[model samples]
Target: SQKIEQNSEALNIQEGKTATLTCNYTNYSPAYLQWYRQDPGRGPVFLLLIRENEKEKRKERLKVTFDTTLKQSLFHITASQPADSATYLCAPDPNSGYALNFGKGTSLLVTP
Candidate 1:
């Protein structure tokens, strides 16, 4: 069976600093990985996605890296603001079915 893991504890960062989050998986080779941001009481919003062959991807202040060999992915937020505080989740496309399996998310808190 495949398993995905993320930090269960909340991350605290000062405003304007970069926040780095991680996702790890085992027993599965996914075609792609996706990152999403979810605010309190709201659904997750897609942030980025990287394919198995892609080394890295970026959008504005966000960046994502996928390492198929290591079975891991990294998510980064640069110059993060208080508004950037939210729970971040990583989901790998199982490719076996239409549904996506998401890892436990990590919460981020940015303070001024």
Candidate 2:
């Protein structure tokens, strides 16, 4: 069986700093990785995706890096603000013809 792991602790960062989160998996090689942001009660909003063959992907103030060999993925948010606060989730698609399996998300709080 495959498993995904993320930091259980909530992260607190000052506004305008970069926030980094981590996700790790085992027992499977996914075809792609997807990231999302979830507020207190809302569904997750898609952030970015990185293919197995791709090393990194980026959007405006966000960046994601996938290392297949290491079985790890890192998510980054640059110039983070209070509005960026949310729980970040990672889903890795195992290419097993099933839907994405999401990991326990890490919470981030950007304080002013």
Candidate 3:
């Protein structure tokens, strides 16, 4: 069985600072890992995806890293703002064969 784990607690950070989030998985080696940001009452917005062969990926102020050996992925928000506050979800696709199952997500609160 494949399982994804993320910090269930809310992460609070001051605006203009960098925020880091972690996602861990067990029982599977995924071909790629994806990160998404979800606002209240809305679907998650795709952020970044890093493949197994790739070490890191970045888009705008977002960055993601994939480590197959550790079975983990790290998500970072550089120079975060209050508007960047949202629940971030991680989905690890096993061999790109099965459906994408997202984790419970870790909420980020960027305050002024």
- TM, every model: 0.96, 0.96, 0.95
TM-score of model 3 (CA atoms): 0.95
Tens-place lDDT digits, model 2, residues 1-112: 7899999999999999999999999987888999999999899999999999899999999999999999999999999999999999999987788768799999999999
Compared with the true structure, the alpha-carbon lDDT of candidate 2 equals: 0.94
48 Cα displacement, candidate 2 (Å): 0.4
Order of models, best lDDT first = 2, 1, 3
Pairs of residues at least 3 apart in sequence or in different chains that clash in candidate 1: none
Off by over 4 Å in 1: none
Per-candidate RMSD, Å = 0.8, 0.8, 1.0
Worst 10 residues of 1 by lDDT: 93-102
Name model 3 segments beyond 4 Å from true.
Answer: none
Give, for candidate 2, the lowest lDDT window spanning 10 residues.
Answer: 92-101
Per model, how many backbone clashes are there? 0, 0, 0
Task: List, residue by residue over 1-112, the lDDT tens digit for candidate 1.
Answer: 8899998899999999999999999987899999999999999998888999899999999999999888899999999999999999999988798879899899999999
Q: Once model 1 is optimally superposed onto the true structure by TM-score, how far is the C-alpha of residue 18 displaced, in angstroms?
A: 1.0
